[model samples]
Target: MSLAQPLAELLEAADRPLEDARAMPPGVYTNPEFLSHEIETIFSKEWICVGRSSRLAKTGDYLTYDLAGQPVVVLRGKDGQLRAFSNVCLHRMSTLVEGCGNKRVLVCPYHAWTYDLDGRLRGAPFMTQTTGFCKENYALPPIRCEEWLGWIYITLDKDRPGVAAALGPLEKLIAPYEMENYVECFRETHVWDTNWKVLAENFMESYHLPVCHAATVGGHSRLEEMECPPGLEAFNYHWITKEASLPMGNAHPDNRRLEGRWRKTTALITLYPSHLITLTPGYFWYLSLHPKGTGQVSIVFGGGLSPEFMADPRAEEYVATLKGLLDEVNAEDRGCTEKVFRGLSADAARAGHLSYLERPIHDFMRYIAERTGGYRRAFAVAAE
Candidate 1:
């Protein structure tokens, strides 16, 4: 119940006006106890995005995720609906599935208790003679799952509001992009040696682009032209209007929904807690984060092309180009975030004032403060 010195400072700093706001204190990232508090207060109750629905295209395709410490599985059922359930077996508590693939029925490797696509217990060998044991009495516990704008989100808190209700304003802001029509090209998971917030903050601001990504995306970012407006209750965002570094970063030749500025602009959005998205005219990529203790983060990284680009005759080349660029950008981000985490543990570490370009980071710090410290902070609507 005792607060670390730096964490206490973080709560104070997060309340400052934007012009006077400083970077969050080191304890925000280094305190193990606070991380546990965050898992319970934020990650457990929020709708955490797993990935795009397109990834589970077939009837039996399923993907597994570790939500905080709990194992979960999201899959496409035989009735053509997406459902989420506890990955642990009803009997003996063994994990039902590992990674992702097509499986007609989920069978526990430990006891061979089989479950149908709908999570009904269909078979259990050697349990037929067990007294008072009925297959109808057992099933995998269902988790709340919903699809919002093509993204699949799951939550352990069944009482939490639906994703669309929480992100309705965001949908209008990005309606022109038709996010649901984006075709997913790839998805991969990785664990990086850094606090989850460090990576989430890194994606929310563009100030580090020119220096951290100098070899790749930084040069094209046009820092002077970037817009860091106030954030909304559900998310924070910034925008940049510049020429696309890769051809696919621009609007596809057939795209007519976007106007002149929208065609060249990119939106960097961080949905409160841990969903970060980079939406462009022709392509999009996102990072979904979950803390793995105080020093590690599990990331669900994925990207794909817009409908226009997917329909292009040279779609394969566009896919290759976009994927290669994103891979390089991710590598650059990894190095920078890992280094920042190391610095936070040093004895001489100190928080510094945030720049105008780092507005999203400041907003993010306030969000953390509000959640973990139970502060009732007001949110200003973000500019489109």
Candidate 2:
């Protein structure tokens, strides 16, 4: 298929500096074919965050993620190692499991085909009648699974470097928060009509805070204090350091070593492909995106308190308040993005100029151009 003209224009814009950059054209958000190309080139090959390994607290604990037309199970085995396997049953391709829980052995509800925690095929009823079929060779196929800072990430492309190697520079910056010990206090899943990139771009900048989040987070958004540092190979980031407006506004006692503004700062990171996070002194939250199609995305929203906040005697009461606050913010974001998606379909809609504050969006545009085959024209511009 020929590249859409509007998309080509957006690609040209992606090469421009922030002062001259344009918001991506509407066609890129509305075109199903472009979305298909993105899925094949980006999502399928990149390392994407699933959730915390802490979610699977014990051997046999498992969770599932559906992406690129496959349901994958990330399971903790008896050996205490986590492995990801295609969740399709071999006999008839039945989905073996749904949601998550402890399973000593995975049994295919369809034909009684069974596999151990490590995904080794242990039984296949009536397999003895098959001419030459062997159980040893029929184990579920494994997807590449790796972890960093207690977060579980998986990639379908075996040769791609692990998330740790790509994100090495971030380790020291993130260690002070001790996110490894932060427990998931709340999580929710929702489907939105907006394209995945729309949400990804929305979270990377604070430009919309004073208007988009006027009722909640906006009052505390100190534009003068914000900064957009250059993104690393693995992610793009923007920093916002100011007091939170909500009840958990008190500065973290654990933030002692964090410099002047760093003590109050929150790093908003968009891990290339689909992981987006906000790390704050008192709490952290993230949205891991999975594109269901050009116009639909599946979002797994999760957040928790910093260890210092969690250890406080008032943690339980604080948890309820925090969740409530985030729910409101999410509702606001969903409404705005969905409206933008709807507007994109209008004939009059066009790309707008970027703000200096939207440097991370510039980084994201460059990131996509560098990785996707559909943007080869844009890649040439970036190379120059």
Question: Would you estimate the TM-scores of all the predictions?
Answer: 0.98, 0.93
Q: Please report how far candidate 1 places residue 147 from its true position, in Å.
A: 0.5
Model 1 score (lDDT): 0.91
Alpha-carbon shift of residue 262 in model 1 (angstroms): 0.8
Cα-lDDT of candidate 2: 0.81
Which 10-residue window of candidate 1 scores lowest in summed lDDT? 1-10
lDDT scores of the candidates, listed in order: 0.91, 0.81
Which candidate has the top score in lDDT? 1
Model 2's number of clashes is 0
lDDT of 2 by residue, 1-384 (tens): 345664576668777876798888777777777787778888888987888888888999998888677789999999899999999987899988988789999999999899998788889988788888988888888999998887889888889987888877676557666667777787667899999999999989899888889888988989988888777666778778767775455456654645566677788888887888888777778999999887889998988887777888989987888888889889889988898888887899988888889988887887776665344322221100
Please, what are the lDDT tens digits per residue for candidate 1 over residues 1-384? 346665678789988999998999888888888898899899989999999999999999999998977899999999999999999998899999998899999989998899999999999999869998999999899999999999999999989999999899889888888989999999999999999999999999989998999999888888888998888778989889867898888898799999888899999999989999999999999999999988999999999999988998999999999899999999999999999999997879888999999999988888888888866678655456
Score residue 262 of candidate 2 by CA lDDT: 63
Q: What residue pairs clash in candidate 1, if any at all?
A: none
Which candidate achieves the best TM-score against the true structure? 1
